[model samples]
Target chain A: MTIASEPADGYAVRSRILNFLKYGANSNPADPRVPFYRHPIFVRVAHWTNVIVLTVMLMSGLQIFNAHSALYWGYQSDFNHPLLSMVAMQNDDGSLKGVTQIGPWQFDTTGWLGASQVNGQWAVRGFPAWATIPGPQWLALGRLWHFFFAWLFVANGAIFASLAVYRGHFRRDLKPKVSDITGLPAEIAHHAKLQFPKGEAAKTYNGIQRLTYFTVIFIIGPLIVLTGLTMSPTLDSAFPFLPWLFGGRQSARTIHFLCAFSFVLFFIVHIVMVVLSGTWNNVRAMITGTYEIEQAGGRHG
Target chain B: MADGATRRGFLMRSFAGVATLALAGCDSISQQPWLDPLLRSAEALTMRVQRLFAGNHALAQEFTKADIAPMFRANGTLDPGTQEYRAHAQKNFADWRITVSGLVEHPLSLSMDQLRKLPARTQITRHDCVEGWSCIGEWTGAPLAHILALAQPKDEARYAVFYCADPMSDSNGDGINDSDFYYESLDMVEATHPQTLLAYKLNGQDLDIAHGAPVRVRAERQLGYKQPKYVKDIVLVDSLDKISGGRGGYWEDQGYNWWGGI
Candidate 1:
């Protein structure tokens, strides 16, 4: 039942090339179309909700980070020895420079980190104004934006995870198989050549995609949430073990920052992959839950 | 391969354009009337959840002396700087007095000497600032519960507000020292918590002017902003509705969430 088994008439490779060339606004193949229901209605809703929630959370989180502009690694800040810090350093005689320090190393990150132009004048800030929520150095509003979205993010994640587990989506789609691990090198080669699974193979996520989603969902996602909770004073009082697990609150802050940036990195790669693979098809799948595969849904190995 | 790469570049640029537009749309709607309260709902949720879990009695982590920072940052106002405050500081705060009034059964004015004689508690704890930094130091003072006991807050009292000497803004056009001063408040539950203190000493010494001299609050389970400094009075009230700007604290009035737990 595999595509190769029915190679004679399952899919016309000639029509596939022509269809890709046509590349209409709607990526619905005209004839011999395999409308694969890749994403369910629930998944589509959760995915889009997260798209908004995570964006607001990241932007507002940056605003909050700009307030302190330094990262320490203990119960309290040493002030002298920070893991990382963004500060406005003044050159001899005049002018301000944004210097970002990572341990012993320092970089002049002017117009961006540490010092940046705010309202047309040079100002000291951790991240640039464009990157933060509310577009100003307003800690109060930044906090409001952050905490508000944080609630949505957590609730959405909780609901998504519960449903994912209950409906066996985690097991059926996200979980990797022994063949996936064994085919790692070959899959890497194929992906390196910008070749994606086509025809029947496009029914589910590839091994690398499955692994990435799994790590992000189960590992990084929970770590970020836990580190965030550790920063709360009242929560610290209730769950003393939170700080202990993270080494300390300051360490948690550093890790939280790192995890945030990790999400950014993941997002970049995700977008690139989507664009490179098939922008309209991938987007349409997420949006409308109907993904047009190369061939008819015969049988997936 | 060249054609595919070219198409990818275009798609990437298009995605970036869409993302930028979305962000701009969000920024524009941030201050809209319809959405402001919706955003504030999280603050209430966080306060309710944290209070539910921690409750009133749970003590913030009490660290050993070794955990204390070498030099605790004296955040917020360094000194009140008003002529009256200057005179009080010059006199070693000997004549300075803190009044307890508002919803209290007995309004009383007590001097620093009398406050020092009240039931005292000392602990080394971390001070978490709203700006994402922390410092640890030892604080010695009368437990706020004992102070409330002496004042005998009335039955309707719900909040204990700490009024400080630090002037936050120049409200008066005359522009001298007549301005709304720094203030903070805690729920009666937090006020009665054993760790909540009207601290007057840091690291076994009288507090320096930079560190809210004469007196300050140590609401151990809350962020630094919840603990006002340079104390002058304690007002017990049933509601925070009538306070300056009416949001509970100075920062709270400035759009910071009233709940300082997180």
Candidate 2:
């Protein structure tokens, strides 16, 4: 059906679908004569590498954080109960089960009904049981993975940053021109109103995207890495400056948790934006490195 | 030159390629079981190299009494709920003798009084726990090296294992309980380090029961768990292979690292 004949909602949905199939909802395809992928092969490699590394780092980090049953604010005396606790155990039927602990200082194993008792023995109930794997558990292996992958994460990030600066990616894609920065008040208002002048979407990134992405790449990423290093006693000894830089080991740990929480927040917003804009188009560009664009009164495939 | 790639381009692409491979390996949540052996080997190699690097330099840091925290929380069993420990405590731990045996030239069971009389080193240092807690405390005790000298470790002895009076039983019966009184072993290098001591006093006062009174081994380089409390004997050994789970400590057997150096 033609765009003119479609219902308003239907038109929105179709546009979304088409957008998803073309550039991820927000990304603009390069001009016809320009290369299909805006990022060079090295940049793409570095970007995906970071994505994978960061995911593993976060998951393994959660596992390590789960090791301590209690988390404190100032000192051991100031320990606060975990926000959520899971009672981990194996069932008679050879399945795993978890009993969630909620509320203040109370452990509830009430939801553990489905699990069968093995050899007439009820499953062990505690925090570690929930997260720790039984018998030659890979805690050490997880640690090694976390440490080794951390190096790659940092190295890849460094390379990406260096290349960005060297290749003018920041200048071209991120940095606002003199007018854009000077007229930020109007630009911000325009964004808040969800209004984009014609041709503006393709040539310029919104202030919010620039600020968020820049913070993730420059501020949050480095903070996560630095705070993580401070948690290591070996590293702390070798680099005395770390503990001082982060207030102390515990403070560093707190910062690390904060940074990780911020990343999770960023991730949620990023996925929502993807879905809101056009999921398929974004996913396709990320995977295949090409996107079709819709020009004024015409379509360019 | 032949590929028409500049040196910078070649280096950049090579790094990116390796990073991609590493990232690919990290992508999957579940790794192949085969990765375990490789990781263990890498960890071992890293540990050995780290040990070598640290050998030439001083390891544990020394602090002042002012730096010592006002209170240090005791981890693990506060009191060994054993009749022997109770009886010993009733006698004021005066009769408690620490036996130095195994691969030693001179095996001796020395009384607490006798241990106190030996040459000692006092230092204020921080005890960091793996659970993300830390406390600084002043400890006065006989240097482990001095005690090892009195016991005269045999040339073959590689590790000094501290056996404690506390018997840790698995009351929960998960088939994991052995002796609850914690045991830890250290390589001879660390065992003989000048700073390594068998602490008898805390904060200028005799140690309290909850704080491993009578005697404890303070391997200050490691986290709090590595410091075995209520130490009653020292057993020198050639290897740790036959120890429980072959890792080196009560917690080490149950998932903690053997070399828990801070």
Candidate 3:
């Protein structure tokens, strides 16, 4: 059951040789090995900052979106309703008194009502008393935080990207090899079988990891930034093309929501993968930049 | 050995501090009398800042023709399903005259053709709906200020009320009357805003029936609903006290803010 106390003769060497032959020639101890992480201190800081800022942005954005419970286009079509609605109180005159229950067509005192006349007169909904806290005021504050933090995010990303190219981090960590491209079926089979090395964590990412990281870096990051900018009226004036790139303000909003959803998905998968591979060890390496490797058969080599 | 404990204590203290700040922020969630004043002041301050910034700058980005969406869905009461509206529509809107009256020194009932002949300003702007959809289209129309100039609004005029053709008697108390046409009012400030216009054309064509044909008001800075369509009359008033629900717009009277600037 253990590597030690078994034998110190030809049997031990024969077992080691057998293990190497079974796994691969690359699994041999004498083979050249990749470092656990090639990420620099700045890169690490940027990554963590991005994580925090993005999380805050998403949470704050949700709060703002909740302000307008219903959405519509053109004039005022009620094709879709908010996910939740509360029953509204009504007066003897058939006027809404307040919200009594929460359901579709229920009166959400907080929701935006379009232009509609009541009792032969125009009436609009008042901002709900409960919404006063994270109301327009809070939204404005959040906007300030989002915009200021965005600068840091952009700077960090720009630095990381330039450094990644200049320092060959992209080439070493993300570049797909010719074999990875040509042997796509084998690569997929390896993933499908979950045949990655057991004890030793992948030094560089596997093919799927590389692709996901690349897409997040090149595609999702730019999208989040561009869509966020498109929402800015001031920014739109400076760069008219930005709004056009994402359709319009409304379309940009849809894209922004979709991107946030994608980021959430990625975060869940990343956390799950870390736990699956080796939770404590992976976390410790990320924090302390070092990890103790267990030798084959559960002994420190 | 002590250093590790000290570091852990520091980390714990920092985390506790952050938690305290977060909790303090969350404490505002509960409604309080004082919080309302604070929020009001904050909103006012934000509006002031936004207004100042916007005034100093040119209008928000205007897009080219290629950027326009192939299809823009008409929002709100597509057809103001009213007998009066249907009658006007049947007449090809020749009988439809926009009455510019009330406090105006010179009241006028201008036909669609007359209104179209007035000097017009065309701008490609985004229409942001509170419901969370947006569309950009080229709108061409006469500045509302220009119309007010022609009508010669009296010195007491404080608001411009849009009277729509849709009626409100049929809804059976859903707060939204199927027979009621949408109506909105703007303070003299927004009414006279340079960008505010009585739009009759969209994307270089006469407004379609679904899009409040004949004429509509475009309060460009505000949300889409403020842009009252199928406008029948523009009534200048000194006070909104007597207006429907005294909130300014139909939706405003229902509980929405009259000034829905982004």
Q: Which candidate number has the best DockQ? A: 1
Highest TM-score model number: 1
lDDT of 3 by residue, B95-209 (tens): 8898889998899989888988999999887776655556678889999898899999899998899988766456687654565456788877778887788998999998988
Give the alpha carbon lDDT tens digit for every residue of A113-211 in model 3.
322233344333223322223433244344434444566667778988888888887898766676656766776687655455534545566777777
Of the two candidates 1 and 3, the one with more favorable DockQ, higher being better, is 1
Candidate 1 or 2, higher DockQ? 1
TM-scores of the candidates are 0.89, 0.72, 0.52
How do all the candidates rank in terms of TM-score, highest first?
1, 2, 3
What candidate 3 gets wrong by more than 4 Å, as runs, is: A1-37, A67-152, A175-201, A231-250, A288-301, B1-118, B121-126, B135-140, B144-262
Find the 10 residues in a row with the least total lDDT in model 1 chain A.
A22-31
Q: Report lDDT per candidate.
A: 0.87, 0.67, 0.65
- The most accurate candidate by lDDT is 1
Grade the docking of candidate 2.
incorrect
Docking class of 3: incorrect
lDDT of 3: 0.65
Model 2, stretches more than 4 Å misplaced?
A: A1-35, A69-152, A155-210, A291-301, B1-35, B38-42, B45-70, B99-109, B149-157, B171-181
- CA error at residue A136 for candidate 3, angstroms: 12
Q: What ranges in model 1 sit over 4 Å off?
A: A1-33, A177-182, A295-301, B1-25, B171-178
Candidate 2 lDDT, A1-301, residue by residue in tens = 2544557796677765674444443333332312245446666788689777777677666556555533333222233343444456555986556555444644335334222243345443332323322211245555656655677788899998888888887777666456666677987686555443323254445666667778888899999988876665545445667767877666677778779879889999888766654566456556666533334333343
